[model samples]
Target chain A: MNDKKWIIAGIVVFLAIFAFPFWYNMGKAAPAPEVKLTEKAKAAKQCVMPTEYMRAEHMQLLDVWRHNVVRNAEREFVNTEGKTFNMSLSNTCMDCHANKADFCDKCHDYASVDPYCWDCHLDRSKENE
Target chain B: MNKHYLYALLAVIVLFFVAYVGAEVFGLRIIFGVLIPYLAVIVFIAGFIYKVMGWARSAVPFRIPTTCGQQKSLPWIQPNKIDCPNSTGAVVIRMILEVCCFRSLFRNTKMSLEEGDKLTYRWEIWLWVFALAFHYSFLVVILRHFRLFTEPVPFFIQLLEKVDGFFRIEVLYDTIQTGLPGVFLSGLVLLAAVTFLLLRRILLPQMRYISLAADYFPLFLIFGIAFTGILMRYFTKIDVTAAKSLAMGLVTFHPTAPKGIGGIFYAHLFFVSILLAYFPFSKLMHFAGVFLSPTRNLTTNTREKRHENPWNYPVPVHTYDEYEDEFREKMVEAGLPVDKPFEKPPETLSDEKADSSA
Candidate 1:
């Protein structure tokens, strides 16, 4: 009988390389988080957009708000409720959420996504954590 | 297929670059990034499989191995085993060497004219070196691209990144950093090699005679890709997180072309898309064809074993029995021994049963 160790190694290596992408993605997805608004956000009367619409597309709203306020220097945000509020993420949005880790960061971390809001905008609430 | 037409083809590619970049700059990012890339990838996979299957289904009936050494006829003569493989195992070894190391190309030689028509031959190692470098580096670069397409890049890929980026230069006594990597070295080397290969095809009389538009097309396309990649990595720096997100989107089939991704990225992407689409239909399919090449895959054991053509058809033939029957009287007169004592009754017999079995 011939010792085919090299051949066995080669076959094993080939299969491993071929199965790389599959194995790499194994258990990669973070478990879904139970995202609940802050007590302050819950006590607030209403949000800038419809609650259903905000749940589905809050990022688009934030992007539009960022562009309007930062790039165009237009700070006006007319909510679907017909109330105009200043387009300030820190002043307007975070005022309701209050705690990023509990409200914003919970969903973001659960999604394993970096919204990069913390990169530029200082989170004053982090000092309390 | 003319050499001059290759120049025109290269110009056409450059024109495409300008058009694609222009379109991206003018905000057709979705078309350039999402739609075209998906279509190109689909065409690439489908066409690649079609070509490979077409070749795989082809009939290679004869043993036509390109032999360059002594045959394995006599027991004493040692054959050049790998180059002129006469067995299945040897053929496998030869194919592995050919595919993995490009062994045949490594043995490339160049002939030069000497004084008074005398000729001198030189080893053409640079071509092999450049070709090998180009391929290995391209592999490395592609592997590194895993980071973009993958969420959390694999450990092996991260290690590769670390090893690839090992070469670093700190200028001004460690005050300033260049961030130049060994990975960039190969990328730049690949560009240089392609350029050199193209120049050889253009400048060398012998190479120019054999060169065609198809030869220059892939090289110039690769040049465009490498140039654009270099530009992105070193010059017009991209938001890599955004790029990775875009890549993940593409892989997941959602394909959201992220905003603020530079026009240069779209241009680079379009070139890669075109390359993939063109690969299966062009000479680039040699990557697949090399394994199926009859010359390299066949063994030189023709004399040792009888090889039959798979497509040989049945044909009626005259046998020795029929010849003997026709010449029976003549053979007896000439004192030749006759089977069955020279059939006097000239009767027709079935040639199929007499000697047809062999």
Candidate 2:
């Protein structure tokens, strides 16, 4: 084969880059993060939306809440089951799921999603600490 | 409409539905997620090596690099280093520009015959622009996907994410703002570029005439993957946590298919797998073959170095000396010069005539 050394080197580089995830992980299983719900969250038995909907779309829902409260000046949210609640992430959602590290940060870190909610919204749980 | 593109489109659609139905209806997440992906990776690596090795084994016996400018010769005359490279360094620079910038394609021209035997050539730049866009965006999207596979996602991936989503375009429907995250521009650009490329192939008469099924298959397949990915991210939001878990598990060799990763995600994976498996067998192998292309990679240094034909070998030949030695008697009889006198002199034609008269 012509330029055999260079060809092999090129393939080696390609394999190293392409199989990066495999070597980077090194067979260490990254177990899916478990969101530890607080006592209040457990006792409430339900959230503003279904658990599945919240799991998939809590970010968008929070964004909508932010827009409504800050931009539209609407502080009230009427759920599908005809229950009305305050549209605040720090006050309302944090009332039940108060532990940001255990509840929010677990899945966010696992999924590598850096939501900017914490940039403005203070974690009261951390404030007490 | 070319039947080739239609067939290619049908194939991609069938593959998509097969994956969707397999995952959603039959609940065969293991097959779609684990088994098929593993198989596709294996096929991709093996097939890629095989194709590249085949190219490497072929002998290029001459310096046949396609040059558009002056080659190295006299000391006073300037040489086009990048265009007609004579040194290894110049060739490397040329290859870099060709690979990264699509420099050759940037020089693409469209030729047309005008009235009264007039021929005209115009620089066509759209293909180069869209091609560059498509390739770079695709690269960014692929790099961003590493976030799913790594446990502590690399710093570079996070930086890439930040750069890609710099615009932070929030999706809002009517007065009610949706909870969707910021849309990354790379995905959108990739989709748009692919659409343009596909449309060009379909809309242009010359391109459409030249394109085969192989040409359309990858485009349609990529379009499907991008479409499904966008759908998952924006519209039919899937449990990204579950998706990441599946991705991490696959990378760590602890394969698991967590529930709630929607059918569209499965469709996306299946399309990617098909592309990977098809890569080495199709024109997509250009990714590797570009390095091996004799016309592109070879340095134009025929004046400096000897390039011997690889197939050249010893050939048996009848030399002039051997021919003269064998026909020496005949040559001497016919009044031709001989290198050596014959031991037994041969009769001349005039002597034979005299003997016949006697």
Candidate 3:
């Protein structure tokens, strides 16, 4: 009954700020990154893990890889698919993906994720391109 | 009240500290890093909306604004518009000042007894000054933490950092930075203000008598958070990269517990989580309640307008025709005028019988 136009405006502004995350994520989701395999990677037979398992648990694999390679100075990564590769993200994963911006960044940007891999590991693939 | 405050403070401190210890020392990373943070955020949002909606639904039944100056009345009178608002524009301006600058709090008057019988009141400035300092510092600290959540951070946030961190001043021959670059001074000032507030409550008998656990608990909790934060920043030196990664992970729903992040980091985080969860249900809701407060929000225009209660129901009434009918004979005896003269029915045997009975 009272003149609450400004009050209403205040509420709306507050809600816009308060519900920022919801609005930001309204039509957005943690995207399923499209893994475009490089020519060399596609030619190779076995990956470290299958696509589904890697999608769900790649971070854990990377963490384990970090512990093994960094702390213990081990160099080999044995895959469940009966194959072995060097334990490294930049050297192994980036070697295959080749394009960090198109391949690795698609999902990270979608989810607002900032990984620490780039803090130490330089994206050498992009430079080569 | 004292017992409640003490117990609540102790409980929050012990509980949060233990959770932190458990997470760090025992490697219960999932709870601290992911689950608890998510729960707290959800609770804070839901509870905040529920409380605000509850206040919005309440009906204000009277014009009960706390006016401290002249109201709108005679044409010749000069109304203090902000202090005693009678229009929407005035109310809005007043509210902005109240919310942004805590205008009402700034007008606080401290009362004390001087020389036994005499009483004195003075404009209190220290409470307002410290309160302002505490809030602005806390705000800066919060804004500064946004860098941890976002990648490449925003430009405005960077600017804010510059402003917050700029503590350089010239002293005679040389300009020197007195505090840690960005947030140390604000953090320390907030802590000091909170300490002063707590001391005031404890030392003053009148304030102490009125104080409750509700008052002390938040102060102690905030102090604990600040203390631990300062420790993490200065002494222990937790891996900020790891902490940021964990924060980003939580935000993105891909939580990662970076190794060697330390328990102190988790402890600071635990305290924050507790604060978020507790904010809506507690007096901290005044953050929203200030806008809805009837005494402060309503206009002072009761004289010019007739406020009809919408809920008022109709009641039966007696007509003048009915009253006249009942009192016609009495009106004739008292020589009072009536709409119609009473008929004298032959003043006969009926009148004699009535007189005998009387």
Candidate 4:
């Protein structure tokens, strides 16, 4: 009961404090203004294309990368010893993994995950395989 | 009393007096808007980085998951698996629910005892509503500001703007007409929600008693930012092209502080800078802290292998035989395990010594 009373009282006080400007503005006239959009901005807006359909070439490329690398290696292993030891997994993996575009673009173009990582890393799909 | 309420009241009074008296006494818009905003930005960036790094450096050595639901238990019991996640995979899902859905907050219940001695648990859903409004509105407001930075606004942003302004009602009365800007509506909604949040903390006795200056300061600063922004949008109009150009200049690394932006915009910018600078140092840093917490990250895979604390030091161990030797007689009398063959060793201590010498 006491808590409820206090909450009600606090809310009432808060409303009263903030309500002043609201009521004052109620009687006042509304203001109207117009803003102009720049021509350069309008031109830029026109060039943007709506992305909808998935490309078949992307899916085929992705299929090649996914099957050729990740599934080729049957076993995964870890080494605690600090040595320049080579693993079969890395041998199969690093060829495609060395560059993001070799793997990421092929799948992302098909998967519908919009290319944000490409903004930072180099796209190697364009490079000679 | 809520310190934020007092601070906000003081800010409104002081800012109003400054805007009215200062402008009347000595007219200056550049000092109010550009210089102060610039200073605030510097402070905010420096402060934000410092605070986040400070949190990152702090070491949390133990695992303490704040669990409310059933933990991983007997296989037949069908564990409330999502609540008490025992693996990294589960933790990710839990984190998603926590961050995106605010799962715990959604389940928040208020308790009350009725007149007939019956206990009641009612959903305190308003807190969730306000919290959602505050976060999403703030997000929309930030996204909307992207329009000023990028030359071409993204399609998603354009879609958001259209969706936001679905109800296009234009009320006209004698040369005065009012239209809605969706971003402005969201900003106002955020302000209302934040105000409510601050009020809840102040009004509740338990919350008020525990509340510190750190808790109050951000709320006060945010309120100031909201109020100043509201003033800029509704009361005083600013030059949008100049503002956009200034933002673009900042992004392009050749910041030329445009002249003609309103003082209220500066006040808003100043408050935002203060918030940014204060973010890393304040309790509001839970935003970054959430990512680093080991309780949320570590898997409960103790059954598989021992997790040796990298910081633990090695210690020597003593055998139980040494302990038994000290109390051998007591052990024999008590029929406990003894080191020596007690039944066969009948000779007294002196006789045994003499026989060995012979």
- Report lDDT per candidate: 0.71, 0.90, 0.73, 0.55
Off by over 4 Å in 1: A1-129, B1-19, B170-183, B318-358
Per-residue C-alpha lDDT of model 4 across residues B76-152, encoded as one tens digit per residue: 77655567777778887887777777776888888878888999999989889888888888877766566555444
lDDT of 1 by residue, B1-358 (tens): 4646468466647746664666565788778778887888778767876776566556667878888677788888888998888878998999999998998789899998889698998889988888888888888888877766665555677677666666643222223323222234667777888888878888888988887778888888888889888776654555554566666666655567776567778888888888888888999988767877788888898999888877679989999889888888899989999775865452334554455665
Best by DockQ: 2
Docking class of 2: medium
Question: Over the stretch B97-207, how does candidate 3's per-residue lDDT look in tens digits?
Answer: 888899888989989889997899989998888888888888878876766665545666667766655663212212321221123466778788878887887777888
Give each candidate's fraction of reference contacts reproduced: 0.00, 0.76, 0.01, 0.00
Docking quality (DockQ) for each candidate: 0.04, 0.73, 0.04, 0.01
For model 3, which pairs clash?
B5-B213
lDDT winner = 2
What C-alpha RMSD separates each model from the true structure? 11.9, 2.8, 11.0, 24.8
How far in Å is the alpha carbon of B43 misplaced in model 2?
0.4
**If both were scored by DockQ, which would come out higher, candidate 1 or candidate 2?**
2
Q: Which segments of model 4 are wrong by more than 4 Å?
A: A1-129, B1-4, B7-60, B116-121, B174-177, B180-184, B302-305, B316-348, B351-358
Predicted chain A of model 2: TM-score relative to the true chain A? 0.93
Ten residues in a row with the worst lDDT in model 4 chain B? B174-183
Write candidate 1's Cα lDDT for A1-129 as tens digits.
Answer: 111353345445744663454455555542234556777778875688876556544655676677677778999998867899999888898888778877877654333344557788878687657
